[model samples]
Target: MNVRREGTAAKAAAPTKTSGPPASLREAGAALAGLSAVFLFEMLDNSILNVALPTIGRELSASATVLQWVTGVYAVVFGGLMLALGALADRVGRRKVMLVGLVLLGAASLATAFVTTAEQLIAVRAAMGVAAAMTTPGSLALAFRLFDEDGLRVRATTLISTVGLAGLAIGPTAGGLVLAFAPWQVLLLVNVPVAALAFIGIRRGIPADQASGPHRAPTDRAGALLGTAAIVLALLAPTLFVDAGAASPLPWLAAATAVVAAVLFVARERTARHPLLDLALLARPLVSSGLAFKAAASLATAGLGYLVTLQLQLDWGWTPAHAALGMLPQVVVLIAGGALIGPLITRVGLDGAARLGAAAVVCGLAVYGLLGRFGYGWVALALALVAAGMRVVGVVAGTNVMRGLPADRTTVGAALVDTVGEVTTGIGIAVSGTVLAKLLTGDIATATWSTQQTARFHEAVTRAGLTLTVLAAALVGWGISRARRPGAARTASSPGH
Candidate 1:
């Protein structure tokens, strides 16, 4: 197997000024709009559907387990297929793969109108997950390829992420409002129009792929199978923990399966001639460190969000609507913070910006762990700080990952960044939920809790928050060490580094 160092391959892949005008947000407005829509679907679909689950249950006469699968299956399939499909995109054509995925997304979403059973909806959601796997990595990869300048790449990424973040933040509320007037099916059917818009924009704005010859290496089928099995099992373990509790052997078994698959997958990649993901590329300081930073940010964000939502609704006696409103601080900061990323990256280099953002997330988690029980003010402050941190780290870390890879590998690199975030987010939520289940005696979803139960709930929150804080801090420290290694100074800023 021939493996090129990240620095050498990056230098070879760097685009010159004469390559043509750099694809700025203004110049690539249509493509960016389309890509933003793709991300919006991914972020919005689950959040919005979650709000309508009760309604779906009533409509379909579904049990709780079926309802869980309705959402769980989508995440499992989406996370599992991302890396393999990303490699496929790199080999075949990013634009071609993305367009086909949009078509599938549209068709699957349209099928929502005809679905009558919970099983059918699960099937449709799984199909949508497949579509997401195909399109999401391409969105980032295509956007990175569009821009020749690192600064433009940062700004473009920030813009796309902002749109998706907005969708995530508002999805629940939007779904509730829509359900008030329309059927639950409308929530998913909305994707048809979104897919259509993305399809048109991508077809017109993005250029066609330049084909690689037939002599290109074939994809490593064994690596793809092992990689997908590992991720699917890893993602499944958390949901199993939440549903089956810690004492149940099912979650533990799933966790063991995940670990074994991951080990075997690594061994496969190391030996494969045309590996789905070249493990050596991850040795690059920027690539690995950037992924570490993203994982840290995602872990903190998801855990905090899950814990705080429960705190407000179950423990504090806030209504669902009120709890949603309470989360406004995070949404506000995430949306408004995009303007700050460029200035921050300009002041601090990308690596510095990533470290700063990661530190803020740790601090935010600490605040919640220590002081959140005192008042809503502390909780709000924690939310804003974490949101701000995530905003910065999300853009800079992803850009750094893209910058570290050669042109042909950007899709898979983007997949790696996303896969890290997905897995860590699942772990974070699982850890928090499992801790709460172990500590609290009664049903957590009950409207009224005894003083003892409430106290236990608060303790659970503190323990979970602090645990996540320590883990995130460790990840950030590791990332900082990696970023400071020799040759790490050759960042995207130089363009010709």
Candidate 2:
């Protein structure tokens, strides 16, 4: 890849002339604070509704499957759109696109608060997904762009990622507090002021950067459609067959369409003047493996979060705050893993890091799965294990991708990182949600379950758990074992390689 500067760090520091003199550290701090607020909102919003799932259902009389739409819809749409929007940021100014995203996000949150019916709520969540899709990619891309020093960029990235888990760390507690005094509607409404504050801050504090060249790159319209089609199909396939009473042929047809679209997407990326995404990057083992590891990491973490929240509320009758707060240990270890031990592990190479870390995730999953089969008492201890495992996975996987890419591609790469993460997370939520839904509908309740229904619940949960665990293990091995290729053949500066 041809970079304007080959060094690991950006050469020029922030100019005091363009944006007033707040001092470098002060400026970086403000930028970080801005991102912290915005990033947490983006991250926590994913599962804040999840903690309230059971309570919302009881209040609104939502069906088992419909309740999950609150979380599932947001994930699928947000993840799918990010890939397109990432490219958009590269082509346009990240700041302008960011402000637009913030406005939409704030408005959507307000709209979510007013939603009354299950369908309205689902639609609002999907709208929020779109807002997030636009806002999040630009923000992350800009974080990498704005921070000139590698040390600062790395620290900023760790901070951005850490706060997301921190949001999850407190989401249940916050949701509970909100539900205690106010309707669940207040939960979403809170996002508006936070987003508005962020919007105002970003407009005033952040300076404009150089724009993409005058020659408009062709929008990867077809590729965008294809990518969206694949995710929609993957998420809807099981749900359509199980929930909608759709014909068997319809689900398979959807899957077939996705396969065809993917083929077209790759072909288009290779030939297009301005491709939506560079699919050729997948030829690099580290990049491809990074994507796969990202997917695998989400599956493990999402599954753990999903089951823990459900078990606490549905089985043991814990409060939402209790359920949410109960996950604190997992959060702590995850943060430590990313910030502290990750760099040391990567110093040894990606394979060693992935091997140790991926195995840690499997061991954690197996332990938690076993504990889940019994009762709630074993949770806190088991979660410690889960945290350590997930932390390793996140740290190693992130290092694999971030360190391997060129400095200039940081914007697109960060967005791509988010895209892979969200898509995998969306898939995990959908798959696990499907399993939980089936169990809930059948007879998995602690008090009100028939023998046959109980059997069905176990069967479904077992299937989901086993499938995720197996895939996590296999992908971890595959990702770590593969030979990594050099960074991209085509960099931003190298117009003619």
The number of the candidate with the highest TM-score is: 1
Clashing pairs in 1: none
Error of 1 at 69 (Å): 0.9
Candidate 2, overall lDDT? Answer: 0.66
> Any runs in candidate 1 off by more than 4 Å, and if so which?
1-19, 212-215, 491-497
lDDT of each: 0.91, 0.66
lDDT of 1 by residue, 387-485 (tens): 999999999999988888777888988888889999999999999999999999987877788999999998999999999999999999999898888
Best by lDDT: 1
Whole-model lDDT, model 1: 0.91
Q: What is the lDDT of residue 370 in candidate 1?
A: 97
lDDT by residue (tens digit), candidate 2, 121-156 = 999888888888777766665665565543455456
Backbone clash count for every predicted candidate, in the order shown: 0, 0
